[model samples]
Target: MRVTRLLPAAAAVLALAGCGAGGGTKAVPPTATGSLESLAAEVKCRPNMQTDADELRQAICANSDGKFILATFATDRGQREWINDAKDYGGYYLVGRKWVAVGDDGVVKALRGTLGGDVEVGTNHSSHSMHGGSAHSG
Candidate 1:
């Protein structure tokens, strides 16, 4: 029993030691839901954002190719509606907590992979776009 315990303890120590200076993979950044700054960091742009009284927030991240909006809904119903009634001129997404991100195919895919979330491609309305939604231009 003592030997078994020591083996487990030793394994833990080795694991900790491996992480000290020579970890295999770099750590993932701590992601923030409903945070424009955090989203901006991942997307390589300062986010232009909007928020409702309900704290429903949207952050627009763009590039030369296209743009997308990352949103946070005030209520689950609102989230459900946005998702179910979504138009796919760009990417459709629901992320952590009350967050959503929208953009075109490539942009959305890249963000989702990096930030983590649910995403879909295509758009229903031409007017519904991530373009120029930000407070500033890239």
Candidate 2:
């Protein structure tokens, strides 16, 4: 019958949806990657203020002057795409192989003395490219 045929298709759809599904999204702290300690120790950030899901492993940091977010990516290419895409935003960015520091002028300038990477001051934050995936084999 029609009901029986639809049941299998509905079950298939549910199975697909279950892939990569989590119970719920969880927030990631600045220290999640253990890199937050290093940055805070070096820059004297207060080691507080975190937000959102762990999609980017993001954390907000503060010092005497201001605050910024340190976002960690799963790979170097992930970091690079974000930085490159952010050129359109024009705000300040301190990028490493796996992390990026995003903030206004004061916060970025505060850490500039010790950190190294491409930087710019602007007003917008463009979205990073995550769909351009590549495949490999070993």
Candidate 3:
């Protein structure tokens, strides 16, 4: 008789489990365009880098119109590190409702001006075998 009573309670628990009572889904934001002209206007000048100069220039110029849509930004150190590593030295800025990549070569990249995304600002500190120690992503 006791076994039968416990069975019903166990079944109830299992049913509730499927309803996602513990960890619910996160809501995705609606797609919307944000003005980047203000941001572009803020970008006074571009940095000089022989390696990825062209790519960086194009990205800066693209945002010059000051029209980009917001998406997601890095929230934690690990995420920021991953982004910085992926871009080699510089960091990435998500713009135009899409995740776009940008490179900053030491000189000022103007974070407050041209970036249009969630904006998770942080630092990345890691030691590479070949590169030794370097400070990246701010």
Candidate 4:
């Protein structure tokens, strides 16, 4: 009967829809390649500040050699202005310089303008390439 044929088609469509919904989505695992020394250096060199650079540097160095989690970058005017006014405090990396964000396990979760624009993560790895995006083989 036509009902039998239509039932199979309907079931197939539902199954296909379920599969499609589940597919095409991936998780971005945390990275573990960050250094506190680099972070400190960035804080020390941050522009537009009225704090005791040397003291701040020493304090940051004291806290160096540890792991951190969750980091973000800013490519907007507001964020840049905030960094300038805040003297680069807190636990965020300074962009426009080579900086990286690490996870609790010390992996590089995300990278910012350190590599320059026009590049994304998981790309190739060549010295000539920006953002560490270069072709590789194993």
What TM-score against the true fold does each predicted structure earn?
0.52, 0.51, 0.25, 0.19
Cα lDDT of all candidates, in order?
0.48, 0.50, 0.30, 0.27
Best by lDDT: 2
Each prediction's RMSD to truth: 20.4, 18.2, 22.6, 23.5
Judged by TM-score, which candidate is best? Answer: 1
Better of 2 and 4 by lDDT: 2
- Tens digit of per-residue lDDT, candidate 4, span 1-138: 111222232223222322111112234323223233454444333222212222121111111223322122322443233334332222223233222322111111122222221212221122454455655657
User: Candidate 3 versus the native: TM-score?
Assistant: 0.25
**Candidate structures ordered by lDDT, highest first:** 2, 1, 3, 4
lDDT, residue 24, model 3: 24
In model 3, pairs of residues that clash are: 36-66, 36-67, 37-66, 69-96
Model 2 CA lDDT for position 108: 55
Off by over 4 Å in 4: 1-65, 69-75, 88-92, 96-138
| Residue 95 of model 4, lDDT score | 36
Q: What is the lDDT for 128 in model 2?
A: 39
Error of 2 at 60 (Å): 0.5
Reference-based lDDT, residue 103, model 1: 50
Better of 1 and 4 by TM-score: 1
